[model samples]
Target chain A: DTAVSQTPKYLVTQMGNDKSIKCEQNLGHDTMYWYKQDSKKFLKIMFSYNNKELIINETVPNRFSPKSPDKAHLNLHINSLELGDSAVYFCASSQRNIREAKNIQYFGAGTRLSVL
Target chain B: TQLLEQSPQFLSIQEGENLTVYCNSSSVFSSLQWYRQEPGEGPVLLVTVVTGGEVKKLKRLTFQFGDARKDSSLHITAAQPGDTGLYLCASPGYSSASKIIFGSGTRLSIRP
Candidate 1:
């Protein structure tokens, strides 16, 4: 069984278009996170959800929204996409205290989004 | 978000060579994690160091935590082609911080 999974491993859309990336975790973790890695290979945290409650929202653009229907899933929606939005989006999950000391995150295969 | 600086943004070495990558930050973190990402794939956790000055080893890989808990290093012994990938360092923000700041990643390539 996959601990974490993301749909549409690759997405290509034109500018001003809207798209969504879906993520799900079967590890029964209480926390889920969305991160974006750009062409520069820099991984940045975009949002975090704890038990379906919004916890951390970085300086991400308003056009990017993360919706958690339940603890098992967290989806990302991008409206009026821009060319700069092209990047690899990754989904991760972890328990409240996933580790004894360091909370380790389990990541799913990333979804590469490309905007023209 | 805390900013992390990783050194030697890109590295290339021959088989059996040894190399080390450093991750530094001004902010203190209770723990720091190391992840390896392959092409077109998500990162996979390699190790996590919680206690300051702690050291851990996995196979030929060695990890060390700074005494101040503000930095860390990853050392690979006898590098191999299989080790080619992106290495990222991330710290689960301060206690109850809610977010993690990941270092810019170091790309390593080993020639067979």
Candidate 2:
């Protein structure tokens, strides 16, 4: 089974449109994160939820918001998307209470977002 | 500014050769993790080093954490074509609110 899964592997939408990407993890992890990989292959953390509690918000634009209905699902919503939003978005999960050594994150196949 | 700086942003080597990728940071870390990512896929965990001067091996891959806990290195011996991928080193952010912060990543290409 896929430990972490994302929907709409590829998304192509016009500028100023609204879109949402869904992510789910079956690893029973306590923490989930959203990351953006730019064209230059630089990965940056955007947000994180620990047990559905907002723990990290990395000064992302107000147009982007993350929602975690529960500990198993984290979804990203983008409103009025711009051309600059084009990039690969990844979802990852990890156990929070484990020792520092076991904090390895498992990522899902990314969703490629293209804002035309 | 990026907290971690990775050397040799890109490397192209021949099969059966050896190569090393370095990740450096001035700030200390509790643990460091290495991940390998292939095209059209997300990165997968390769190894995690928590102690200073710790070394771990995975078959042909060797990972080393610096004695100061502020840097790490990955060495591949007799690299094969299958070893070609993007290697990234990451560590937890300095603040409790910040999650994991990834380096600039090094793209390794192995030619047969």
Best by DockQ: 2
Instruction: Grade the docking of candidate 2.
Output: medium
Deviating ranges (above 4 Å) for candidate 1: A98-100
lDDT of 2 by residue, A40-104 (tens): 99999899999899998888999999999999999999999999999999999988744666667
Worst 10 residues of 1 chain A by lDDT: A95-104
Candidate 2 residue spans exceeding 4 A from truth: B94-98
The sequence of per-residue lDDT tens digits that candidate 1 reaches over residues B65-95 is 9999999999999999999999999987665
TM-score of every prediction relative to native: 0.95, 0.96
DockQ of each: 0.59, 0.64
Tens digits of lDDT, candidate 1, A1-116: 98999988999999999999999999989999999998999998899999999988989999999999999999999999999999999999988664435577889889999999
Q: What is the C-alpha lDDT of each candidate?
A: 0.91, 0.93
Native-to-model Cα distance after best TM-score fit, residue B39 in candidate 2, in Å: 0.7
lDDT at B101 for candidate 1? 72
With a 3 Å backbone cut-off (N, CA, C), the pairs that clash in candidate 2 are none
Task: Return the clash pairs for model 1, or none.
Answer: none
